[model samples]
Target: MSDSTAAWVAAGVRSVIGAHTQAQDAGRTDDVVALYTPDAVLELPGMDPIEGHDALREAFKSWAPTQPQLHLVTNTVVTPGAEGEATATSDVAFLQRGESGWAVHLVGHYEDTLRRHEGGWRLHRRSTTFQ
Candidate 1:
């Protein structure tokens, strides 16, 4: 693809990563869900799929109290698609405040489908698996 197209895809993926970290750090569950499309779905291990914004909101609200101190995304690959759609995958690490300091609480990856909206790219679906 052209350099300009590649840069746009990178920017879109970066926006998702930024929103995730910012919302988690601030404990803004609403903001977290806002990064998703209204009909977005989230799938994580051992839990039924959370579909739509309302369910996504509740899921994030329940998680916010855990206060995961850090959200890190790395090794991202974004593939732009036709008609303003895209897909991305990234390695993620979640850190928590330990008695000593920040400790690795979880390691995982996110597989996402994103679509451009009025505001920019928004996640249409996200599947997360922790290891």
Candidate 2:
């Protein structure tokens, strides 16, 4: 890929990751699942991998936030792969508001594999490790 094309691909992948965090924070289960492929796999810390769109929807629904939540994603690095595939790593700070005010709930890093789709870039697999 040319320099411009590589940059575009990285941007698209970053957008997908951003949208996923936004949707999750907003408790939009459907939107979160839409960011992933139908057969996507999500591995959260201390949990078995959640696979497929159906499972993903159910998982998101079960953990839907009741309080205000925000995900601060930073230091994202993307690597372009052959044609339609790419990978990314990002640091995340998950915050939630409670009676005491907002507090960081989790600090983690996400490793994701993404693939270009008709709609855009979708996460094919994501593995999160908490710090």
Residue runs of model 1 more than 4 Å from their true location after superposition = 66-68
C-alpha lDDT (0 to 100) for residue 117 of candidate 2? 76
User: lDDT for every model?
Assistant: 0.86, 0.94
Give candidate 1's TM-score: 0.92
Flag clash pairs in model 2. Answer: none
lDDT of 1 at 36: 89
lDDT of 2 by residue, 1-131 (tens): 89999999899999999899899999999999999999899999889999999999999999899999999999999999998999999999999999999999999999999998776999999999999
Best by TM-score: 2
The alpha-carbon root-mean-square deviation between model 1 and the true structure, to one decimal in Å, is 1.5
- lDDT, candidate 1, 26-70, per-residue tens: 789988887888999999999999999999988888888554488
TM-score of each: 0.92, 0.97
- As a TM-score, model 2 comes out at 0.97
